[model samples]
Target: MYRLFAGIEIPREIGEELQAISKKVTGASWRPIENYHITLRFMGEVDRNTAEDLDHELSLIEAKQMQLTLSGAGWFGSSEPTALWASVEADEDLTRLAERCDRAAKRVGLSLDKRKFRPHVTLAYCKGTPLQEAAAFAEKYGFLKLGPFWADRFHLYSSWSGKGPSRYVSEAEYPLT
Candidate 1:
């Protein structure tokens, strides 16, 4: 089975900016620069046939480019936060793209997480991190106000997590006009 997901890659410039602001949080395991992406859907583990089906369905998705902005920083989980993430504003184009991915996955008989799509690029994974400290750090950064980057493509990424930090490899690229 292949562990996979579909997401938009963050530009190098924006990743650098996010990396700069990721420090000073105690007990936080920061994500590597290459791992920064706005996940459209997490497809989890699937067999080769299912992956191929998803690839075919995804490639058929035709949508226009989206003006994406990386904005704000925050942590999920109320007490003892589990992750610190950079928020993404989901405009209509982004929403449509995500929906198309979701529909494709569903059509291919892949079960998806039922959570509402809250777009974010995870900055770090936290272990027993104090809520106040994380909250303070988030408040300090508040709104990130980064570029309105143009997203003309998204990818099918395979993750390898056995090592120190999870490594994401792009298995397929699907472009939008």
Candidate 2:
């Protein structure tokens, strides 16, 4: 079985800017810069044949390249904090791309996410951290303008993490024409 997901690849300069924000925000758990990505669809562990079929189906998605900008910050989970994330400003192209990915996944018998798609790059996963601290950290560095970039391609990634940083390896890339 393989754990897979589709996500946009962030450029190095933007990743560096996010890393700087991570350093400034104290008391909150920070996700490593290498793991920074905006997930489009997550398809959990599946058999090898299903994975191949998913890739073949995803290859047909043709979205026009769009510009994406990192604009704000937010948190996930209530009660006990679960994550800190950098939010993306909503754009038609981003939403359409995500919807196309969803449609592709559904065509291959994968379940579509019931929740509305909200795009963001997870900055941290909080474990027993105070919510107030996390919120404050977000407020302090949330206004960061990481500029913008053209998203020209998306990837089908294989996720792997044991004890250290989570690693995502791209198995296939689909270009947006």
Candidate 3:
């Protein structure tokens, strides 16, 4: 079974800026620069045939080039603080593309995701990090702004989590017009 999702890659320049801002926080496993992306739909653990069907459905989605920006920094979870993430400011085009990815997953016979589409690029995975550290990071960089980077395409990404940070591989690319 392949673990997969549909997502947009962050521009290298903007990613570097995020990296710079996220440097102060410790006690978390930071995601590699290559792994940064805004997930559209996480279609977890499917057989080869199902992956193929989802790929075809994603390929059929028509999208135009759209701009995305990083508006702030925050962490997921409240008391436990499961993750630290950079917020992606929402765009209508971006949301529409995400909805299309959601539709593709449903078309491939996957169940609906209960969580609403909240756009974010995860920076680190927290393992018992102190709440105050996350709070401090939020206080310092919560209003951080990065870019209006152009997204020319989205990808079908395969994810694997084993030892360290999860590795994301781009299995297919769907270009925007």
Name the best candidate (by lDDT): 1
> Relative to the unseen true structure, what is the C-alpha lDDT of residue 28 in candidate 2, on a scale of 0 to 100?
58
Per-residue lDDT tens digits for candidate 1, residues 1-177, read 999999999999999999999887788999989999999999999999999999999999999988899888899998789999989976988888889999999999987669888888999999989999899878977878788899999999999888699999999999989
How far does residue 89 in candidate 3 sit from its true spot (Å)?
A: 0.9
TM-score of each: 0.97, 0.94, 0.96
| Model 2 Cα lDDT, one tens digit per residue, 59-175 | 999889989999988788777668888888888999998998889889889987887889999988777777787778778867866768989999999999788667899999999
Sort order, lDDT high to low: 1, 3, 2
Worst lDDT 10-window in candidate 1:
137-146
Evaluate model 2: give its TM-score: 0.94
**Deviation in angstroms for 63 in model 3?**
1.4
TM-score-better candidate, 2 vs 3 = 3
User: Evaluated with TM-score, which candidate comes out highest?
Assistant: 1
Any runs in candidate 2 off by more than 4 Å, and if so which? Answer: 24-28
List the lowest-lDDT window of 10 residues for candidate 3. Answer: 18-27
Superposition error at 18 for model 3 (Å): 1.4
